[model samples]
Target: MAMEGYRGFLALLVSALLVGFLSVIFTLIWVLHYREGLGWDGTALEFNWHPVLVVTGFVFILGIAIIVYRLPWTWKCSKLLMKSIHAGLNTVAAILAIISLVAVFDFHNAKKIPNMYSLHSWVGLTAVILYILQLLLGFFVFLLPWAPLSLRALLMPIHVYSGLFIFGTVIATVLMGLTEKLIFALPSYSSLPPEGVFTNTLGLLILVFGALIFWIVTRPQWKRPKEPNSVLLQPNGGAPEGVESSMAMNFGNVDKSDSELNNEAAARKRNITLDEAGQRSTM
Candidate 1:
């Protein structure tokens, strides 16, 4: 990113971290002060783990993973290292999500509360399961050596969409979970009790945090600029990777020998560019 963009990114980055950490702190207060301290035992304390882990792992770290590429400083990092970090953070999120799921079920079974009874549980579990699948696919396809660039490009859109989709879905599910917990635990929630108000505020913070991340991710200007050594920069020519990698692919080997192949390349490139430019101008 340019220096000017770096300043903007830095501002938003700090804002995101502040909100994210506030969420973590608020979750702690809610669980420890209101819901009782955390524990692995089959009790409400055990269920408390659900909210904490979800807030930290799914809402916070998972969000960071989603936008890691947008961090201007990390733009200098190797794409493979970035991929590893992305996969690592997501792994943590998935592990925490899975543990939270277990915590909920364990508490439910111990108290005979009935499992998968609420919309929160249903959707939350679905998100976790999907998240795990996403994590596995990302690690195996992106981080592993055997996956080809063609395969990566083909799946890139689906991968990107599913990631953001899951992130948004998890946030919505968290909101539902918070509300559900408040209703069950606080009979006076309708009156807007102190705990209820605080929890609602925390939810709002999380929602805003998500909005900021989406803004950072979706903005064309904030997308990561291609590094010099990026696969797209290779001589063979290929479409750039996700985020800021533009749809620049060599139609043919621009440096290749033979006039016939050269003509073909020129023809293809000219046709596509003119067509695309015309569409944009029309738009």
Candidate 2:
């Protein structure tokens, strides 16, 4: 059977992406129109780049990178191609995040403001560092040709958990950063000015988007379907028999019997043998 609820999951993914993009756009407008605009020179306006780029890259682009493999259409593509796209998008997000940090630092230094003073800064920096480390480990373990299969298998769970954790952490950091910005920039954020209202709405949208993305990624039934020609096959150039049936056994949906496994294996072996024999006869 096909993956259950995949259509609903896909719809949610699209909705989350739309909400996320709107939030980013709203943030830019808030910063540019109501507050200082973006710049690179040491000014308050220059610091606007920090929030804009962080929301765009760290939240939106990074989120897409994390979920690219879950896209239904991507199942038809080679696993290697998907992996390359995932890595490349993450690299771009990292670069944007780094530039955003530079913008914040430059503005603070120019204004003689202390850096890393707020809880937002502390958590945000930690999240960025952890994210970069995760990316590096994922690249070396999964994408590179040198890593052993055993090592990849061992690290796979850790990598997945840590990635989800970091994604949540980044969203939390963004919310904290928004709160900090509103407190500092708005004279009466409690009373709710237009800017404050807009900012708060943007934060809510971001929170919803992040949550939806996480839900989509975590749902096992929403996982991409395994293609017949997947690159995940054994080096001997054949898909492993009984993998799916074995999984069904755990759910009591399929009977577990040695006879069944043996028969399946025997059939696969017989097919291979017949194919080889036919090839020889043709030659």
**Cα lDDT, all candidates:** 0.86, 0.85
TM-score of 1: 0.81
lDDT, candidate 2, 11-77, per-residue tens:
8987988998998899889888988677778998889998899999999998898889888767778
In model 2, where is the ten-residue run with the lowest total lDDT?
Answer: 230-239
Strongest candidate by TM-score: 1
Which residue pairs in candidate 2 have backbone atoms (N, alpha carbon, C) closer than 3 angstroms, thus clashing? none
Angstrom error at residue 230, model 1: 3.2
Q: Which digits, one per residue and each the tens of the lDDT, describe model 1 over residues 146-214?
A: 887777767778899999999999999999999999998999999999999999999999999999888
Q: What is the lDDT of residue 138 in candidate 1?
A: 91
Candidate 1: Cα lDDT at 148: 78
